[model samples]
Target: MDLINTCFEMCDYIEQNGVVRLAGNVKLRDNLKKELLHFLIYISMTDGRYGEEEKAFIKKKLGFDVSASMAADIKNRNMLGAGYITRVPETFKYFILANAGHKIKNDRYDNKEARTLAETYRKLGQEYLAANTGSTEVEINVLSSYCVMLDENLKSYGLLRPDYKSVAIQAETADEKEPDADELIAELNSLTGLTAVKEDVNALINLLKVQKMREQMGMKQTSVNKHLVFMGNPGTGKTTVARLLARIYKAIGAISKGHLVEVDRSGLVCGYIGQTASKTAEVIESALGGVLFIDEAYTLTNGKGQGDFGQEAVDTLLKGMEDHRDDLVVIVAGYTELMEEFLDSNPGLRSRFNKFINFEDYTAEEEVEILINNCKKQEYMLSRDALEEARRFFTERVANKPEGYANARDVRNYLEKAISNQASRIVGLKDVDKNILAMLEKEDLVGIEL
Candidate 1:
C-alpha cells in the first residue's frame, strides 16, 4: 500500500481501538492525517532516492503494493509545497514503530534493522519539526544521538552524509536560542572571587562570540580551540569555573551542550592494559556535546614506565578531543606544578590546550564569605563574635600555614565542625528556642584548628 493509504488505515485502527482520543474537530483529525502522509513522504525521499527495499518494506507492513510512479509523484508534490510535519502525535510514532516491527517479524525481528528504522523515524520526526518551526531549537544532546545513529545505520549504506550536518541543524538552532552574551557575562562577574580567572573566561567567551558573528557575516573566521588547562589549588573553584565556562561556551555557540562531566584518573584508567582505552572512550562518548572535565588530571600520568595503562587512556582521550573538537570541550585541572609537569609529559597535550586559566587561592576574606554563604544556606547565623573569630582564625591560618591551605574547602570543613560543636553544646538545652538554634556563637568557632 502507498504511505497515505497506510496512514489512513492506521488512523482507522487508532480510532476503532480507542488507542488515542480523537480530536472533536473533524478538520483537526483530517489535518493530522495529512501531516502524517507528508512526514512519510519526506522521510522516504530524504536521501533523494526511494529504493526497492523501502517500497517492499512499506508494502509488507502496510499490506498493499505501491508503484514507483506513485512514490515519485508524492516526492514531487512534497517538494513543490506539501509543507513539513511539525508536531507528530505520540500515537503515530508508536504506529510507525509497530509497522516497522511487523515488516521484520518473519526475519526473526532483526534487532539491528528495527533499531535503525526506529531511530530513522525518530530523526525524521524531529527534522520535520525543525523545518516547520523555522527554528532548529531541539536539544543538542538529542540531536547528537540522532547523528550517531545516522552514522551507524545510514552512513554505511551511503544513505546519509558522514558529517551529519543535516541532523546537526537542530543543535545549531538550539545554540541560536542560547542566553544573551551580556547575561552570561553578568553571571561570570557575579562570582565571588577568581578575578583573574573570570577575566580570562570572559575574554574567551567574547572571542568566540566575535568569531561566530564573523561567520554569520560571510567574513573569514578562525576556529577557536576550546580545550583548556586549569591550574590551581583544591577548593579554589576550578570545577565551579569549568561548569560556568561550559555554559558560556554553549551560549556563544562554541559547543552544543553545556553540561560538565567530571572525572579523574581512576574513572578513565583501568588496571588492565587494553581496558584503559575502551574505558576512556566510553567516558568521552557520554560527554559528547558537553564538557569533559578531568579533575586532578595530572594523576593520569603518575604511572611509571611504558607498561602503564595511563598512557593508553591519555592517547584515547587526546584522539577523542581531536575527533569531536566541534562539539566537545575538554578541561584538565590540577595543582599548578603538577598540571604543568603532566602537560610536559605529553607532547600532544600542550598544543591542544592553548588556553590556560589559573584559579588563585581565595583570600582570608573570601574564605570568610564562603563560610558565611554556607552558614546562610544551612539556616545558621553566625553571631558577631563568631564572625570575628572566623575571620581571625582564617587570617592566622592562611598567614601562618599558607602552604597546604585548602581555601574554600577548609572554610566548609570549619563550618561543618562548628555546626557539630553547636549541636554538642545545645544537647543539654531542653528550653532552646529558634534564636539559639539558628545561631553559631564564638565558642562554636573557637579551637577548631585548620
Candidate 2:
C-alpha cells in the first residue's frame, strides 16, 4: 500500500488495540508502523485534511488524547535534546498541533485548527518548534535503540511527534565528527616533510572536485581515479594519504560507504590451497565503501613454487579489484624497485596500477627538519647551537650510514634518545627553572657516552 493508506491502516489498528503491541505475527508491520508514524503525520499535516482523522486515529491507537498540556511536559525548551518525538516520547509538540491543525482545516470539521496550532506554538515557542521541523517519511523504527536514548521512556508508549521535523532534527542532533577534506589535507601537509608528495596530493584534490561535479550532473562515467599505486619507502605517509582518500570518496558519494581498511600480506594470503582467494575477497568486501591499503604488497609474491598461496592471493587481488572497481580503491605500497618487480610478476598487476607516486628519500636538510619536528613533538628543548650540532652530525652520518640506513626515521630516533638522556640528567633539579631548560645549549646535548 501507499504510505498514506498504510498510515491510516496503522492508525486504525492502533486505535482498536489501544497499544499497537508490536510483538508477534504482525511484529514487523507494527515495527514499520512505529517507524513511519512521524512521516504519516507529516503527510496528514500537509494540507490539514487528515488532522481530525489522525487525532481520532491516535486516540483509539494510543488510548490517550494527544493534547497541548501533555506536550509541554515533554518538549525540551533549552534545545539540549528535544525535537523529534519517537516511539513513546511526546516531545514532538509540532506534530501534535500540525495534527490538530490538519483536522480543524478538514471540510468535514466545523472549527479552525489555527487556535490549537497557535496555542501549541506559543507554549512550545515557534522558533524552537520551527527548528525541529523535518520531512514526512521519517522511519523512527529503523533508528537504533541507542540513537533514541533521549526518548527511551517512549519505547513502550505510542507517542505523536509534536514537531513535524523529527527526522531532520535527529540528523542535526547526531554528532558530526568526520574531518573536512581540506582540514585533513592541511594537517597531512603539516605532518609530512615531502614537498613533492604534498603537491601531488593537492592535484588529487582538484581531480576529486571534478569527479564530484560530474557526479552532481548525473554523469555516470567510470571514475578517473579507480586504481592508484603509492610508491614510497617506509614511513613516507602513504597510509595517511590513503585514509584521507577514503573520506574524499565518501564526500563525493563515489562509494555507498567510506572507511579505510589497512592490511599487508598477512591479511590477504592464508597458508592454504584454494583458500587464499576467498580470504582476500572477504577482505575486499569489508573495504567496499572505502580504501584498502596493502602495505608491503610485494610480499604477496614471495612464494617460490606454483603451489604457494602467494600467487593465489595475487590472482584474487587482481580479480577483486576489478569486481569492485566501481566502489573500492586499492593502494599497494612498497619500496619502489621491489614494487616494480611485483607488478612485473603478473601482467595484470602492471596493467591495473597505472598511476604511481614515488616517495624519494629525505635530503639531509629535510632529515634535520624531521629531527627538530620530532623533538618538538616530544616536548624536548633543542637550543640553537645544539640544533646546528645535531644537524651537522646527521648530515655527516647520512653521508656514510650505508645504503639501507633508515634515513629520516633513524635521525628522529637518535635525536629523541639524545634529548631523553638530557632530560634524565636534569630530572632531580626541579627548581632549575623552565627558562634554563629552554635555553639548554650545545653542551647540554647528550653525547654518545650517555
Question: Which candidate tops lDDT?
Answer: 1
Measured by TM-score, the strongest candidate is 1
Off by over 4 Å in 2: 1-176, 219-222, 256-258, 304-306, 401-403, 430-450
Question: Which pairs of residues collide in candidate 1?
Answer: 1-64, 1-65
lDDT values for all models: 0.65, 0.54
**What is candidate 1's lDDT per residue for 385-413, written digit by digit as tens?**
99999999998887775666788888889
Per-residue accuracy of model 2 over 244-349 as CA lDDT, tens digit each: 6676566656666667889998898887777888999899989997888999998888664766788888888888888888888888999988898889888999
Query: Candidate 1, which segments miss by more than 4 Å at Cα?
Result: 1-181, 402-404
Count of backbone clashes, every candidate in sequence: 2, 19
What lDDT does model 1 reach?
A: 0.65
lDDT of 2 at 444: 54
